[model samples]
Target: MATAFYSHPDCLLHEMGPGHPECPERLAAIEDQLIASRIAEAIERESAPLADLADIARVHTRAHIDFIERSAPSEGRAWIDPDTSMNPHTWRAALRAAGAAVAATDAVIDGRYENAFCSVRPPGHHAEPARAMGFCFFNNVAIAARHALEVRGLARVAIVDFDVHHGNGTEAAFAGDERVLMCSFFQHPFYPFSGADNQAPNMVNLPMSARTPGTAVREAIDLVWLPRLEAFKPEMIFISAGFDAHREDDLGNMGLVENDYSWITEQVRRVAERHARGRIVSCLEGGYNLSALGRSVVAHLRALAEI
Candidate 1:
């Protein structure tokens, strides 16, 4: 089955500001690389639908959803946090970004596609149940996981986050939930410093030091993530695909490259094949350096598409 690619034009309309790292151009950069690599033609494309308020409410508080809706600006940008802001189109963009994850989950679970990649943004993984931070308005992966459990009747699911920073919101959402197992590695002493401690039994969070290389990531996956994931035997797998850890990205200090992204994706794919029947849904989270992000996404898609 072909990999489903989920995105929306509104994702390109949610601009943070001038010179912001998490700008709308990031989606275009990935598309440009997809076309250049000849990968776009091989995949199935679909427009992301708006996520229902009930779907958003699964992982976030109703008050939080209402706050985001009410917070939409009429003329200019509204700053939610110091690093995150919203333009006029941000509300719809955030919905589509989250909706892409839900749609991808349905496609993969229903066997319409074996796997899916959500290329929408206002990247999630930073937004918590009641708060939005790090340019994230909603926890996209968390909502997808919940949908798989509640709506699709999935008993087990796994989330793998390889961002340069920790998926604190994801961790928070499934902290005590045994149905979901989350494994990840992130640069410690970085932004939103929290994942190093207070880890639950179901969460395998490894805190890598600054300037850590891809070797450590591979070791963590081999020694830590894979073992736990294999034991979990998840029915579906979710990925918080973040490429900012690439060595060229100035957003964070890490030594990952395109090859590293491909390698990690292959490892995840192997896990999905083993126990999940090759069901995987990956959502874009973070990646700043435009060239590195584009190249890394191509590598990731190549692994997901097995092409």
Candidate 2:
């Protein structure tokens, strides 16, 4: 079976500000590398559909949804937090970003694809049930995981996050839910400053120091995350695939490189093949340096496509 790649042009229309790290060009960079490296021809491409409000409401409150809807600006940017904002096209773009994740989940579950990757963004993971923060508008992975469990009738699912920062919003969404198992590692004392203490039993939160190397990350995954995920025996696996931990990225001080992402994806793939019929859906979370982001995504896709 082929891997599906989900994205939309609408996602490129939303931008926070002039020099913001999370800009539309991030997607363009990935596209450029896909073409330059010939990975574009290897995977199946699909356009992302807009998510229904009901689907979004599974993880976010109706009031929060309404707030985002009403917050769309007519001309300039409307700030949600100091670092997050909405432009005229942001409302539609946010829907497309989340919609990509949900659509990819369905495609993988239905066996249309062995696995999938969503390249859309206003990058989610920080957006909570009642608030949007840290360059996120909706918790896309959380919403899709809920959909798999509640709407699609899956008994178990797992979420893996490897962003430089903690996935506070995703943690909030599935903290106490036994049906979902979340494994994540992020820089300690970092932005959002979460996932360090008081994590639920189902969540394996590993906080590393600023200069932690990829070897330590891989060891942690093998020692900690793999055991929990193996025990969970998830029917599907979801990844909050953030590449900002790369050494070239200025957002964080982690020393991860392209090979690190490929290795991580391979480990996740092995688990998927063992228990979940190779079902995995990965959505883009963060990667600021355009060159590094593009290269890292290519490495991730090569592993996902097994090429």
Candidate 3:
């Protein structure tokens, strides 16, 4: 089956600021690389729909949703946190970003596609149940996981987050829930510094030091994440595909390259094949340096598509 590619033009309109690193150009960069690499034509492309409020409520509080809706500005940007903001287009863009995950889940579950890649933003995995942070408004992966469990009757689902920063929001959503297992690694002593401690049994969070190399990351996955994931035997797998760990990204200090992204994707694909019947849904989270992000995403898609 072909892999599904989900994106929306609204995603490109949710800009943070003039010189923000998490700009709309990120999507264009990926598209350019996809075209240049001749990978765009191989996958099935689809426009993302707006996520339903009912689905959003599954993972976030109604009050949180109401607050974000109320915070949407008519012309200028509204600051939720010092680092996070919402423009006139941000609210709709956020909905589409989360919606892409839900649509991807449906496609994979229905066997319309083997797997899917959602190239939407502002990056999630940082937005908590009641709070938004780290350039995220909604926890897209968390929402998708809940959709698979509650709506699709999936008993077991796994979320794999490889962002350079910890997916604190995702961990918060599924930490105590037995239905989901979240495995991830991040640069410790970094932003939203909370994953190294207070981890629940269902969460496999590995915190690496600054400037850690790809070899160490591979070892952590081999010795830690893989064993736990295999035992979990999830019915579906969701990936928080972040590429900021690339060495060229100024936002993160990890020494990962495109090869690291490809290698890790292969490892995750093996786990999915073994336990989840190759069902996977991946969403964009973080990857700042445009060139590195584009190159890294190509490598990741190559692995996911097995091309």
For candidate 2, the per-residue lDDT at 203 reads 92
Clashes of each: 0, 0, 0
TM-score computed on alpha carbons, candidate 2: 0.99
Q: What local distance difference test score does each model get?
A: 0.94, 0.95, 0.95
Error at 77, model 1, angstroms: 0.7
Clash pairs, candidate 1, are: none
lDDT, candidate 1, 1-307, per-residue tens = 9998999999999998899999988999999999999989989999999999899999999999999999999979999999999999999999999899999999898899999999999888999999999999999999999999999999999999999999999998999899999999999999889899878999999999989999888988899899999999999999999999999999899999999999999999999999999999999999999999999999999999999
TM-score of each: 0.99, 0.99, 0.99
Across 25-53, the per-residue lDDT of candidate 3 in tens digits comes to 99999999999999888999999999999
lDDT tens per residue, model 2, 133-225: 999999999989999999999999999999999999999999989999999999999999989998899999999999999999999999999
Model 1 gets an lDDT of: 0.94
Name the 10 consecutive residues with the lowest summed lDDT in model 2. Answer: 97-106
- Looking at model 1, residue 156 earns an lDDT score of 100
Indicate whether candidate 1 or candidate 2 has the larger lDDT: 2
